[model samples]
Target chain A: MSPLLLILIFIVSTVVGYMIIKNVPSLLHTPLMSGMNALSGITVLGALTATAFALGTGSKILGYIAIVLAMINVAGGFTVTSKMLKMFKHKEVDNK
Target chain B: MSDILFYLLCGLLSVLVLVGISMMSKVEKAVKGNFLSTIAMAGAILLTLVYYDIISVTSLWIFMAIGLILGVIWGFKIKMIEMPQVVALLNGFGGIASALAATVIMIEPEQQNQDQLMFILVTASLALVVGVVTFTGSMIAAGKLQKVISQKPVIWKNHQWITGISLVLSILSIVMVAIDTKFLPISIIIGWVMGGFFGVAFTIRVGGADMPITISLLNSLSGVAGSIAGMASNNPLTVAIGGIVGASGLLLTQIMCRSMNRHLLDILLGKTTSTGHSKGVAVEASTVVTASDSEEDIVSDLASIIKSAKRVIIVPGYGMALAQAQHLVSQLSDSLEQNGALLDFAIHPVAGRMPGHMNVLLAEANISYEKLREMDDINPEFPNCDLAIVIGANDVINPAANTAEGTPIYGMPVLDVDKAKHIVICNFDLKPGYAGVDNPLYKMRNVTMKLGDAKDTVKELIDMLR
Candidate 1:
């Protein structure tokens, strides 16, 4: 994708996000924030590529650290969200 | 042909990911919605990486596998109560990753066409600044929230001027990069340093009471940085996700600001000052200071009152989290229900360190969301209630937010527990909450302070009730 097209998509998604998040009840805001925090960990994709294609030892080391950090964000974030969401069960249904 | 199919799949999954997050709140099966959306998002991200050939190298698999294992292990090892800290740290990691990715792009003198050079520099600079800021700021925030550092707002003279100058310099450095100046590498490093300073400078000055908003803002910043990074890398799907994360984070930040009755500017600029309680005296006429009350007397009194109350409301705070007492509270609530007293929970929006922190805790303890009423929904019902049991909560129940003016937390919306006919407070000490203001609600004639560990106090009450 071209940078221009990517920018357009970014703008559209920002608007879409604004509209969708407007209605989130305060009760769920914390989890929603965390869930999104996890989603933003998508930067792991960048880290993976950057590390793989790193030109030198310095960039390679930095890229490796970035990959580890981003991966932590992604894996930990999703697990935590799901765990928290799992606890949000209705009264009648005893999932635990 | 496969490329076309892959692009279509990415587009569809991107939409599903956004739709999945939005529907999480309304759906009956929120977990299922969250699950599907999370998976779709992961799928889309992975596919995009593969399609771009970013993850094609067989050697990269080892690093990827190791990183995933470490992350999953850390994630599962953490307790649910530490969700805020985990989220904060994760955001920090995202920020740092974006910064490092941008760093790699900036340092390498690779394929850059003249037409796109300016755009790339702009995006790279943005990713660097925002990412660095979020990284350092979130680390401080997570540490403070976890109480590894003092949660008090750290203020020093001449701080505001320092932050302003640093931010301006950072922006100037970014402009230098965009202008294709001689000091491009030097300018990039300056941007990162200044951005890091801004993050710490901004966060360290905010009091613990304002952490939720601060954390949310930083989280949003990480998203914005990721988006910028995506734009720089020419990844459309990543840009979209970044956009979604950033926008939603800002919206939540706005809501948090409103709940505190403070403007976003006030929070960001450190305009709000903590109204420290100089002396532990009751300022409100309605509040009559009671010499520190004994625990046994209050618990027994609470037992008798619970026996007679027709409706009871349990208001929880971070103290409940502190004492690790949600399960005990749930058990007590069940016993209360068994004893013919109707019970409901009133949760302040910013009750815990994180958003919805109390809700998750309560739900974990098997309390139904139906029984947990939001402040707006439950405040009016307090007047008719027999008793309001506040566990380790100070600021949220402080009537000063409602009736008092000129106090730092004056305009903040607090639980109307004072409206109840009787109130029982379970806390360890007479110490003020994160806001550092003595709670005027404590001195109310109807309020009883049961000073003890929340879990022990509540457990004893349960035994007595049984």
Candidate 2:
């Protein structure tokens, strides 16, 4: 990937993401934040690549730790967000 | 995978993530939206393994499994009230992950052309600095939220000077590493140490009330860090998803800042939540109400007020969460409805420790989402309300926001609780809230202050109706 192309992707994604997230009501802001928090852990891709291409034991260990931490962020963030969203039930739903 | 095919897949996955986020705007579809995002993430991870030819890496799978187990356990176990700190801690993990990945990139020998190597080195160093700062800053924020550290703003002597110097040094180190590969080892150390100091200095002076903004900002930084790390590694998928997270966090930060009428720069410079501290003391002395009636008389008066009310609005704040009084609040709302009163909850955007946190707490207590109204939607209804019940809330309902010029909360939007015909307050004490601005609403004749732990006071109110 060229640097110019990568920068373009970042800009396009950010603008589109902002427009989409703007529609989320304040009622769901907490879940939105946590869900976004999970997406930030997409850095796990970088970690995996770095670990795979690592030349030294030290670099490999660091990559492993990064992978683990990013996975925790992704898994935990999504799970907690789902839990919170589940609690937002309507009166009719509660009655049922 | 060929480069063309890989880029196409990245684009497809990014769209899926965006569709998932758009679905979050509606309550009904939000759960499925989260699941979709989870699937997209899993797909992205699997794609990385195959594209990079690392599918057979045993150590990677073991580490990821360990993380998955821990994450699931913690996610299921955390109470709603602890969401702020837990989110902060998770943000730290994401930050450190990016930092570590950047570090590995910096350490591994590069086979790229000279220009490409320079770009990669500079971006990697930048990512490491941002990632480490986000990690340390989030840990401090989590500590403050959990009360492991003091919630009061910690202002060291010449705090701004320290923060400035550390930030400058960190940037300089990044530049040096980019200019010369020989400075890599020393530059990495300087980046980590200076970045850590800068993070702590930046966060230590942010008082508890400013946490919503701080957490949002740190969340944004973590995403930016991940995006930059992706740039360093030339991973388009990481860059795209990380950018989306960054944008989402920035939007939330903007909303939180607007709701509080605070400037992001003022918060970054640690100028908030401290201006009214001395002024608060003077206001408190003159405004203390001396109850002329006995305790029973007060209770009876409140009970009578509740009995006659036909429409009610409940305002809940962080103190309500602290008192674990949501259940009692839910009960009170139920009892009020039984008396034929139309009831709704007014949620300030900055209420509780994080954005929309009060709603989650209320939801946990079995209050239906339909009854929760945002400040703008509910403010107009207050004037028509027969009574306003404020539970462990102060600044959000403080009438001073409208009249008290030069105060920290001046011009900040607040729930118009005073517009209601009658008001009842259940708070811990008469002390000023986190922003240190004394509430003028407590002095109004139409308002009755029930000073005690919100749990006990709300339970008592429930008992009175029975």
Candidate 3:
């Protein structure tokens, strides 16, 4: 694909993604966020793959940076999400 | 030109992926939501790289699929009960990812040009401050929620200076870390610790009544941090939408605080935490009056109550939050509707756990949002109402704010239910509301306190009307 085509693809995807999220009603935000926070954990893999690839191809600088960030994004996201779920702690919820 | 486009693509994908995951799990098992978002994010990143000729598709697939499976399992295990911790985790990761990105660029010797280096450095720094604060502060919040750390006020004698000095030091460290590495990391670490310290101090000191606002405040902070991540990545859409969440959440928290007459400084300083020992107390399961005569008891009293009444209003509070009695309240409203009586909801801004909490609860039971009235909107109507049924509500209905001269919740907005001709409070007890103050609304001459478990009480009242 041409460079312009790739950039266009990126832009279109981003817009499509943004519209999907932006349209949700305000009431759904917390639950949405709660769900997203858990999912954000996967961004670690993205960061890692991007970084590792960036590194593996001799772009050592961007590569290392990506790895460090990816790890933090992955690990940190999960930890925060685990903690978020604690606030709703109740006995009834537990039996579930 | 390509770098900018790449950054923009990455940014959009990040938000889109997160949003995609959010929708997939609405209120289903929360873990499922997190798993979906995580997998989507991981996939988006891999796809972006392959599109850019940065990475082969094979490795990206292998790595993320493993990640996808692990993340999904983890997401499923995390109960909704752990949501606050999850929020803290998100804030921490946003901060940490950026900080690490900055660290990578700073230590990089392979800089072909200064522009990329500068981009990385600034973004990393942004990440460091936000990440550290979020990471540490969220830990403190989690600790408080988990009871690992005391949630009681940590008011030192010199709290203002302590909070102030830490904040100033944090600002100073930003410049210091950028200029030299010797103390920057330590400073950043300290700043992170200070953020948590202050957050806990701020949160623990605030009364339990203000927990919803505290949750909202932290939520806003998390949103701001996410926007910063977007900016560091040169993503405008992330910054824009994140800013919306951050700003709106804070506004909601502020409105909730104001309606309660709570001062911002007081909440931060932990002033009210110790003073309101009466908060969170379960009201005794007793009533000043009971209707055992069933239909005859309600029917006999209904005619007189409805006959002399000019209007009738219903007050819903935390008890309603616990009982989930909104539909029942609507039923009661329908019964009164037959008597040619007017019925309205007396909604105090801070009536329940979260702002608009009662309204939200009622909306779930399919109550019309328009039928719910705000304190300012419906206070004038209380005087004309022949009956004000106080259902599981306390502080907002208390007349002491207007008549008792001095109450902790003085000047806070409330329904003038005391002004009505007949007041019936269906509460478990008169112990106090979350504020720990005696409600003179109970003592009104026309007030007849009907006590029982809220659900059963309302059900009995409904049976009588039938």
Candidate 4:
């Protein structure tokens, strides 16, 4: 990939992100942070590719560690945010 | 043809992710959309790897299985109280992932033939520094928020110099790696290790009071690191998601800083001193004194106040969560409503250690969202409120923010409970809040201090009202 194209992708996504995020309410900040953390977990793609093509033991080990860490972010981020949003769902009031 | 299809899929999935994030705050059943987008992201990653022939089907499946099991277990095991720290740790994990990926990619010998090798190396170096710093800094943040370590700012007079020097050293090592200079391996190690040290140094000086800003900022840093890592790997899928996360986290950090009325630089440099120390001294200098009322007297007095009051507002804080009193507080509100008094809840943005924390607890007790009012919306109603009951909340309801100067939280916005005809403050002790400043609201003439465990006191109040 050309450096120019990658920079273009980076710049465009950033502008798009700013527009979307500015609408989120203060009440959802924690969930929003966690959700973004999950998205950052996309490093798992690079980590997986790195491990599969690793030329040496050092690269292989680092790749494996990276995969594990990224998975934790991916899985934990989505799960936590989901649990939190569930609390926001209305519940029937028990007058007891 | 297959390669084209794979790239197309990745592009489509990236769009889905953007759409999911935008819908998350707007729609009901957002979790479902989030999961669908996550699946699409995972699919894009897998297909891209296959197109590159980096991993065969069997190996990819094995890695996916392992990753899934670990993720599910970690997610389910986290309790409600641990959510904030767990989120912090997740952010740290993302940072470590990017740093590790950048390191592995940098050590490869194939970069010599790449036309954009210089740009890739620079991006990799950026990832290495940012990722290392975020990883270590977030771990420290989680520790402080969870009380695994001291919640106070651990600062020395030379703290700024120490952080500045370490950061410089880290940058120099990264420069060596980026420029293909001598001692490559040693420089890489030094760069990341010093970056890690800088992370710890940057976080330790921030007390718990400013943790929301710290956590959000670290989240943003991890996103920036991930984006750089994406560029280093020449993967657009990672780049897109990383860019979105980076931008969103940055915006959220800005919003948090604006609400706190502090600059991003001031927070990072540890320049904003919260009168945490001076407030302790002010405790002695404070001339106004009042006798702490006993529980029995408080119950009797509160009962009469409730009887006469037509409108009441409740402001709950961390202490309420600590005592697990949301259920009782809910019942008390119901009792007030039954007595023909209109009851409302005022929720502070930073209340209960995280944003919307109080809301979750109250929602658990089946408190309607309609009855919950934000600080700005509820402030105007205080003037007409017959009684304002502050349960286990200190700093948010502290009158000092408005009336006192030179205090750490002096300019910060607070709930104007002072404007009410009567105020009842319930707390376990007279200690100042996380900011460690004296609360002048306790000394006000219309205020009554009811000291006890928040749950038991609220239950006692319920009994008295009955």
Best by TM-score: 2
Give the runs in model 2 whose Cα sits over 4 Å from its true position: B111-115, B277-288
Query: What is the per-residue lDDT of model 1 for residues B213-252, given as tens digits with 9 covering 90 to 100?
Result: 8888888898999989877766667788888999988887
lDDT of each: 0.80, 0.89, 0.55, 0.79
Best by DockQ: 2
Candidate 4 whole-model C-alpha lDDT, 0 to 1: 0.79
Q: For residues B1-466, write the lDDT of model 2, one tens digit per residue.
A: 8878888888899889999999999999999999999999999999888888889989889988988888888889989999999889988999999999999988974733356888788888999999999999999999999999998889999998999999999999899986889999998899999998899999998988889999999999999999999999889999999999899889989999998889999888888765656553635534445644576787788899898899999999888999999998999999999988899999999998888899899998999998999999999999899999999888888888899888888898999998999998898888887667878788788888888999998988888788
Worst 10 residues of 2 chain B by lDDT: B279-288
Candidate 4 lDDT, tens digit per residue, B303-413?
Answer: 898778899999988888889888899899988888899889998877766555677677667677667777898999999999998898887787788877867677878
- On lDDT, the leading prediction is 2
Q: What root-mean-square deviation over C-alphas does model 2 reach?
A: 1.6
On lDDT, the stronger of 1 and 4 is 1
Q: Candidate 4 clashing pairs?
A: none
Error of 1 at A85 (Å): 1.1
For model 3, give the TM-score of chain B: 0.71
Residue B46 displacement (Å), model 2: 0.9
lDDT of 1 by residue, A1-96 (tens): 667788888889999889988877776776687788878877766666656666788887887777777777777777777777777666667644
CA displacement after TM-score superposition, residue B116 of candidate 3 (Å): 6.7
Poorest stretch of ten by lDDT in candidate 3 chain B? B282-291
Q: What is candidate 3's lDDT per residue for B172-212, written digit by digit as tens?
A: 65565556556545654554566545544445554446655
Ranking of all predicted structures according to lDDT, beginning with the best and ending with the worst: 2, 1, 4, 3
List per-model TM-scores for chain B.
0.91, 0.96, 0.71, 0.90
The candidates' DockQ values read 0.67, 0.87, 0.11, 0.64
